[model samples]
Target: MEKSEFDLIKSYFAPLASGYEEAFDLLNDAALISEKPQASTVVTMDTLIAGVHFLMSDPAGDIARKCLRVNLSDLAAMGAAAFGYSLSMAYNSQIDVGWVKEFTTALGEDQQRFSCHLIGGDTVVTPGPLTITITCFGSVARHQCLKRNTAEVGEDVWVSGDLGDSAAGLKLLNKELDVSDAEARAQLIHRYRVPEPRCDLGIELLQNAISRTAMDVSDGLLADLGHIARASNIAVELYEDKIPRSAAFSALMSSSPDLGLALAVTGGDDYEIVFTSDPAQEQAIQELSRKLSLKLSKIGKVVSGHGVRLICRNGKTFLPTKAGWTHF
Candidate 1:
């Protein structure tokens, strides 16, 4: 016999909603969210299809974490602190009671780690692929949220942490790339599975007034940069050499510099925050880096023009085969 939807909610999800009082214990059709004084609500949503966002063979817990973190990353981009989330899970036949247990267990752990709760959501059986959609709610200082179109000409461009590991990790999983080092393989694949949302960095950026223009690198660095550029009506001059890479990532692509760098910038899924700030903020950013213990790389600067230009190590312009990933 299969578990009923209400049974699953009581057994697994209700406990997760314990963080917020207004969740109504998930008994009501909808949960009410109220904003705090002087704080504005920040909402972000992301959908994950089994084959599209993750693999069916991937660990159920990891899939749940990834689904949640990606949306959290969006909150981080807006310099917001997450409070709770509503999850709509489209489960397929392959999902069983045991699988739900594993999935919800991870969500419980992450809720504790992120200081959030599952306010409300729906679970329905799907005839198609297993899908997860998370609508996350966060709070930010009123009228003080990061905006993509705020990049200013002559400001320094920056990226947090390393890039390309996730993309390369996916390639390793698909057997398109060969990595001989076991630790390297693990490092790359772990990045693909779990992303580190720079929540602290976002908070610092907002609280200290270090930057005003920012977004997380989700769809790929180059492609995402294009969004800021077009939105701000400015051009970006990216130095290929300045794009940071992890030791594992560098080792994996050492022999093929061109291909390696291309994949690193265009592979997407990095989830690191990218922002533009005045050159005067460099010192503050460096201090923040040390405080957060996360590497923040200034790879480029905003220029008065359109689109992005990748400057090669040889001091010449280099164009990638493709800018980034697209569903279509």
Candidate 2:
């Protein structure tokens, strides 16, 4: 008796689409488009469910942006540029016409910002929580793409932007902290809603051979660095004092002594780039950051060991209780 929201949204995509089925035709055969000479294609996919990846109370538009950004962060980890993407959505009955419009508007804006073209995807009615799946494809020169297993001893560890913002933002949403300042609260909330993917920085690093190995800090710094250490078969030693902290985060740490800095070190969803380079490339990275107006700082160095060790200024060893988030 009622026109479904899915039908209404499907009509909007039909007119502007090149061909929905044609877009997926390439993927259906289990083969990607042929690679260019001496070039490599980087592909990554991430799925987010309403309650699992986001709160049901969050704005639909913000949820849509998060779905795209988290997937884009994966591409940044390998120093890839966005080429195209596909989205599969499982819509529940609760998706009203206004919600769909807002969600699609945000998705379109992100697609433009990231320079990615949406090919095609399946949308269907579901009986459960809202689910969105995005698969992103990117490209890099064969030798330029940073691999997780490429870190070397003596390589300098670097991170772009301060850590702990996203985790702190979530805490604020849960009302764990009562930050009275509007601007400070807004900054934390922004980190949670729209994570900067560091795509431009990642591409520049690859093009200029700035980083020997790289990974985006979707997970917390300490935990993510541990991943690079494990993957590259090298140990990493980070100076706790050297790790950068945002002004808001610093204030939170000072006020909430029980809320350990370890959360910032081990929390997830920072989405900044964590990379490894050496002394030889340090100047080059610095130059690139200056030219691009990106803040890139060396926080630590790779060592010869199996795991990560945090060295405090007082010569105390700090090991994180948790490594990172596990979907399983």
Task: Please report, in order, the local distance difference test score of every candidate based on alpha carbons.
Answer: 0.91, 0.78
Residue-level error in angstroms, candidate 2, position 213: 0.8
Question: Between which residue pairs do clashes occur in model 1?
Answer: none
How many clashes does each candidate structure show, in the order listed?
Answer: 0, 0
Off by over 4 Å in 1: 321-328
| Model 2 ranges off by over 4 Å | 1-9, 14-38, 257-260, 322-328
Please give, for residues 115-233, the per-residue lDDT of candidate 1 as tens digits. Answer: 89999999988999999999999889887798899999999999999999999999999999998899999999999998889988987898888999899999888889989999999
Assess candidate 2 and give its lDDT: 0.78
Q: Give model 1's clash tally.
A: 0
Cα lDDT tens digits for candidate 2, 144-226:
77778999998899988888888888888889876877898899888887788889888887787787588888767777887
